[model samples]
Target: MDYGEPTKLVFSLQDPKPVLCMNGDVKVTVEPNGRRKHWDYEVTGSFVQRACAVRSRAGHVVAQIGVKGMLAGKDFYHVVVQPGYDQAFVVGVIAILDNIHGESTRC
Candidate 1:
């Protein structure tokens, strides 16, 4: 696929990472390389999500995913992902992050 082309990819989490493919063939994972946490993240099979800050090699960010009434009717979240970066993957990671925060706040 060429740059600027739109290709939707769904995602889910079992642990660490897992993305539902566009063709619905299998669950994919987009984790950083071993011992590299803040490096490149693979969003499409083996494609890098970010070519630089605030943008991806696949595409640019179309919209953000945030929630209102998070605390005291406040809006929160600063999710940043490009259009063709597989929203499902972004959402899945967000879910995990939220879950971790929620669990941590429990006790």
Candidate 2:
């Protein structure tokens, strides 16, 4: 599926009180690389989110965070991130709707 233009979002990191917001719609291009699919995202967000005072080997911030928006019908998806030099943690958020079976479904 083609998402057309990328969506924008924001992320707030506690501790020095840093806020990151994308200037425009991020461009996400997904392609198949070998066995796993690779997602290439190009975004120009504000200051990266960092936790604590740890720094990288190159003397950079230890962590960073960002957010992205997704569409699940009328509901929306928000992605939280904890970016590091080698790895990152991502969290996805979606609206909860009451279904007939009392369960949530994704559009």
Candidate 3:
């Protein structure tokens, strides 16, 4: 695959699941530098209980354990990815939301 091509990756959850725990569409723009690449995106939503791992086509993780949350009715999250680490980063955001809201469990 050419590293100069623009790519868009998306992950979504369907019905039977509450939208409160779902994350909105995440758009990643891949741009090429001199000998590396860069990625950037904006997230909009609340109560995101997901963990994502973004990797490249060569299996290099560009992002890991990306968590999304809300603060003062604003969307806030942290993406632990290092830019220009590799070429063609494939992101896989996993949802780990469960019925912990009504349960009393601590770890």
Candidate 4:
């Protein structure tokens, strides 16, 4: 099986570092590499209810994900991606968030 290209998850250390939250809330900048030369996207929200939103540099909410329901003790999340945004990328970021917070994607 072929895994896709490398995806990087960068956390800011200063200037615009992410805020700390006991509830597992996170804020991160995505795709800041110099080659593409574009503004980075930001993902922010809480992991408790799987509520998260991705915002563009222009301060628009391009995508958001939240718990839609629970069944058999498992949560179901609903994701909404605005036009011109990458849906897969948004979901990938959420997956990374889940992994980081020891949620659904934990080992």
- Best lDDT among the predictions, by candidate number: 4
- Write model 4 residue lDDT over 48-85, tens digit each, in one string: 55776777767799888898888887777788999988
Please identify model 1 stretches exceeding 4 Å from their true place.
Answer: 1-29, 35-38, 41-63, 69-81, 103-107
Model 2, which residues run further than 4 Å from truth? 1-59, 73-84, 88-107
For model 3, name the residue pairs that clash: 55-90
Model 2 accuracy (lDDT, Cα) = 0.30
Per-residue CA lDDT of model 2 for 12-107, tens digit only, reads 212221235323313223332335333233223322221112233244443334324335533232333336423321221111111321435354
Q: List RMSD in Å for every model shown.
A: 13.4, 15.6, 13.1, 4.9
Distance from true position, residue 53, model 3, in Å? 1.6
Whole-model lDDT values for every prediction: 0.37, 0.30, 0.40, 0.63
Total backbone collisions, model 2:
0
Q: Please report the TM-score between candidate 4 and the true structure.
A: 0.65
Which is better, 3 or 4, measured by TM-score?
4
lDDT of 1 by residue, 14-50 (tens): 3223344422211223442345333223222211221
Candidate 2: residue 32 lDDT (0-100): 28
Cα-based lDDT at residue 39, candidate 2: 28
1 or 3, which is superior by lDDT? 3
* C-alpha lDDT of candidate 1 relative to the true structure: 0.37
lDDT of 3: 0.40
Clashing pairs in 1: 19-28
Model 2 lDDT-worst window of ten: 89-98
**Candidate 1 to truth, TM:** 0.33
Model 2 alpha-carbon miss at residue 11, Å: 24
